[model samples]
Target: MKNNRNRQVVLKSRPADIPQAHDFEIVESDVPDLLDGQILVQNVFLSVEPAMRGWVSNVANYSEPVRIGEVMRSFAAGEVLQSSHSDFKPGDKVMGMFGWQEFAVVGPAAVTRKVQEDDLPLSLSLGVTGLNGITAYFGLLDIGRPRPGDTVVVSTAAGAVGSAAGQIAKLSGCRTVGIAGGSAKVAQCRELFGYDEAYDYKSDNLDLALGKACPRGIDLYFDNTGGVISDTVLRHLAVGARVVICGTASFPTWDPWPNGPRAERHLLVKRARMEGFVIFDYASRYEEAVSRLSQWIRDGRLRYSEDIQNGIECAPAAIAGLYRGENTGKRLIRIR
Candidate 1:
């Protein structure tokens, strides 16, 4: 074994709201021997997403919650160190739900996909070419169904998924408007992601800003944060508009069930549609999305950013940082 000891961050306690470092504890253990059908992977990068909050929360979600004392659930990029499965072999690069650990012994089913883009950075597997890119590609194109010249607005515009969604919308010849937390992110939306118009939801009067940005009303709304921002966007939906609910970062908890303005009236008045999709539902088409996104990257039609922090110790804090809007793009912890 390259290293006998494996370090991991486990969920120490469930957080009432935003996760804190105290909610997790780092522990070290001996690397286990791989069993039949199992692969031993040494993680290179650990991804942190806003959805993680729900994973550890007691609330009922699409997936099962991570129990206390378990390795915090996470998607990671890593290399296969040893494999007992015929489908996998040593030296293979892979991405999967390897959790917040330096090393993981998981069955082949846990391996989401084999990393094949040697020309691309392995870290990109956990970001642009991985979950973020795939989510944006399917959510925007399939769910949002953006049309050319459509006014498409995205919340969390500078984030990993949101940035990709906005850029993809632009590629579809839609006019894109972005809503971000601060001026810097707003600027990143307009300058970095090529959003035609960008607004700071934290500072700008969102209702009026949406009015100015989408005078023709929003033909498509890629909503990552659900709260007042989404409520405002719902009010401005163009006739037959499409809304994709990708995340709800604004809500601290769902146990109490946070309430907001009803969207039924807006949908009724505009004949619009709103829907949510889990990335796992589109797993069969993951490689397709990755291939197309990679091509876009090569053609210079797409761009993405990473807010990488070194070491597994940063794993706990990284989740909280995302909710604080501290990350500039995809938040990752370098395990090596």
Candidate 2:
């Protein structure tokens, strides 16, 4: 019999707003015998991203909700320890849709892509070159479409997608203005994330702060936080601006899925454009983004950050941290 050798975090409860520790139950399980073409992988890094929040919700989205009592849904990076699959071997590093667990028995279909070095860390394969990177690429280039010399504004600008979006805007020859939750994150936006200007949205006078930072009037708005902050940005948009709706982290809850930026009048006034995007729409083009983003990192034009927490036991709090704006950049849990 195959030995039981996995540690996992199971969803204990459906969260009302932000998930809490009580929502997960960490437990050990027996591993089943390998099927015809399966591989056992020791998960090394697991992505604890804001996108997980949308997946946890019962609301409509491109991705399905994580069913109650299931292992919390997640993306993970791992090393193969045993393989019955012809394509995989021990020690091969892989990235896949593994969940909140330390070990996974994946068939060929579960493996998404193999990790290879191209002047970047393996962990970043879970960040900039993976789902997060693809989201930034499509959301900014296709939806936010900034023009040269235009001023682009990004909310949650120190986080994974926001950081990548701002840098891409700058590379497109636009001035980038970033707004994030706190002083530390705002600092990272300009110095680390390569934004042209940045502001702390926590400032009481956020509207005034945005007005000052975006003196040229916003040309393209890559909105990761949709709410009053996004509302204020819409008022500052230049004529013919584009807004990409990627997130609403600024809101407290999603049961009602709080509304954001009733800027229809602003869009009408400025002759601007607004659209909602889910990154999975461009999954086929993910390789194109990975190649370009990896090059940028090699050329010293791009950067990434991770707030890694240890163990599956911390998964619930780690995931919840994103909603509280407690994480500095990309958040992940080290499962092994």
Candidate 3:
């Protein structure tokens, strides 16, 4: 067995704005023994997402906030070291809310699913093949309801979820345009993700760029950033256009409620539909999305990127970096 000592990152303080390293504290403790229906997992990789800021903040969100002095909540990929449950045994690979810890003792509820794609890397269970890809799959297909020959525009188009959604739209026979930050990510949106057109949201005249790229208007808008980018896309909606609000990465604080242009006028004029998408709503159908996503990877119809940082200590800093648009793909922390 590995050493009994477990190192964990816990919430030290809630950030006033973007989460910083000072917001978390790393502490060492003894790994607890597993009880009946519990499994001991040795965490290998930890996910760093923009949503994590909400998880740690005092602000209300869809999920309960991670309490102070508790291990910071996170999705982690790891191997079961021991199991008191019949369904899981030693050496079984799994992914779940294992928190920001070196070792986790959890029940079945905390275990999202057993990692079954043996040919794929375990780290992927936290990235493309996991929530990121699944979110894109259902949000675009089910919510956006993309049709052939439609013009789809994706905000944060080079991001983990955005990239997947864009490629999936292309696979559905829609013309895809990507909006990302910086020249590199715009280039990545075009070259790597195969977007028909990509614009740097920072440098380009967004209104004119969107007008030119989506000449016929946007049939589907997979919105990951819900600020100015979305404000711009809403103006370009085609008749009956569908908008999927996946994330609001641009908002530093939702406390005072940052003011923005209302979208009702645009939706009403175009008779469009805009709906929020939460991945947890489709938890029952995760396998369905994963199965198709896996096949897409096998068929070369899908591709993904990962920005992996070494060491569990990097987990806290990674969240802040993600909001800064520092990562090109799914950002993960490899526990060393």
Candidate 4:
């Protein structure tokens, strides 16, 4: 038996649809003792993000794929339980690329940040105020470039990244619209996320709803899911509109790459610009975004929520939940 010390989630199988519980297995293992610049962290919270599906898919992407039977990759926040690294210390709370496991042995190079436990919720360091928040800032403003009085629409608007993108667009003085999976999420978008308009993709005809809300036409569209949703938005783009492509959650099938409705005619008619961005490329500008978002959060200008599950044993389930739209806000599994 592989009798090590960490409780980790390993790939048990691949899925044809939303990942099921059986797709992963829990096992115990121990990391080797820390070397000169390494540290062992007892995970405090494991993040369950939508992009995890892409990471596990068979198709090649910007990064290498996670191999079958390997520990599932995740972004997590934890405490330094043991350390030999010059920068980290015992009792420090940090966020990094540590995957789904109770104990993570990571070197200094992978650590994204060390956080403080103050009035702000610590778990959020892994969510809205962390990567998701930063992603919304850069992906929406730097890429989508919503102009004042212009209309902006976001898919998966009630999700972590989508919700933040909508709110930030609203703050930028643009008319904000949202497309979410259910009525509950739609309500959250109009009320909680402060979207000027929101529609349930499950109930309302997306074309009709988007047409109604964006009568003036979409000036900026931030896409988290592609396929029909993107096609619908493409038909409504105003002249010179900017579209930021983030992810494609709608396509569950793992083909070689994404191909969808031909959008060239829409682009030509609107004279629009559409670009895809991987947030990791903006790593150097992360600090500036975090500082701005933190201020907005502190000034009662931001409203954020969370769906947190307890224990590392539930970590695999948490990651699978994002694909099925099981989480409300930022999905997290508490692992202390």
Model 3, residue 335: distance off in Å is 1.0
TM-score (all chains, Cα) for each model: 0.98, 0.94, 0.98, 0.94
Give the 10-residue window scoring lowest on summed lDDT in candidate 4. 1-10
Model 1 ranges with Cα > 4 A deviation: none
Candidate 4 accuracy as TM-score: 0.94
Query: Candidate 4, after superposition: displacement of residue 215 in Å?
Result: 1.7
Native RMSD of candidate 1 (Å): 1.0
Candidate 2 at residue 113, lDDT? 83
Alpha carbon deviation, residue 156, candidate 2 (Å) = 0.4
Which of 1 and 2 is ahead in TM-score?
1
Candidate 4 colliding pairs? 4-29, 4-30, 5-29, 5-30, 6-29
lDDT of 2: 0.83
Tell me the spans in candidate 3 whose CA falls farther than 4 Å from its real position.
1-3
Candidate 1: how many backbone clashes? 0
1-336 per-residue lDDT for model 1 (tens digits): 545999999999989988999999999989988878899999999999888998988888988989999999999989999989999999999999999999999998889999999988998898899999999999999999889999999999999999999999999999999999999999899888999999998889999988887888999999998988899889999999999999998898887888879999999999999999999999999999999999898899999899999988788888888898899989999975
- Measured over all alpha carbons after superposition, the RMSD of each candidate to the real structure, in angstroms, is 1.0, 1.8, 1.0, 2.3
Model 2: what TM-score? 0.94
Please give, for residues 1-336, the per-residue lDDT of candidate 2 as tens digits.
Answer: 266578888888877766777878888888767788999888889888877777777777577888888888888998988899899999999888878888888797777788875456778978888888889898999888778998999988998889999999989999999888888998899889888888887774778876887776888999888878888888898889998999877765756756554788989989999999887678678788988999898998888888888777778788777778888878888764
The 0-to-1 C-alpha lDDT of every candidate, in the order given, reads 0.92, 0.83, 0.92, 0.84
Write down the TM-score for model 1. Answer: 0.98
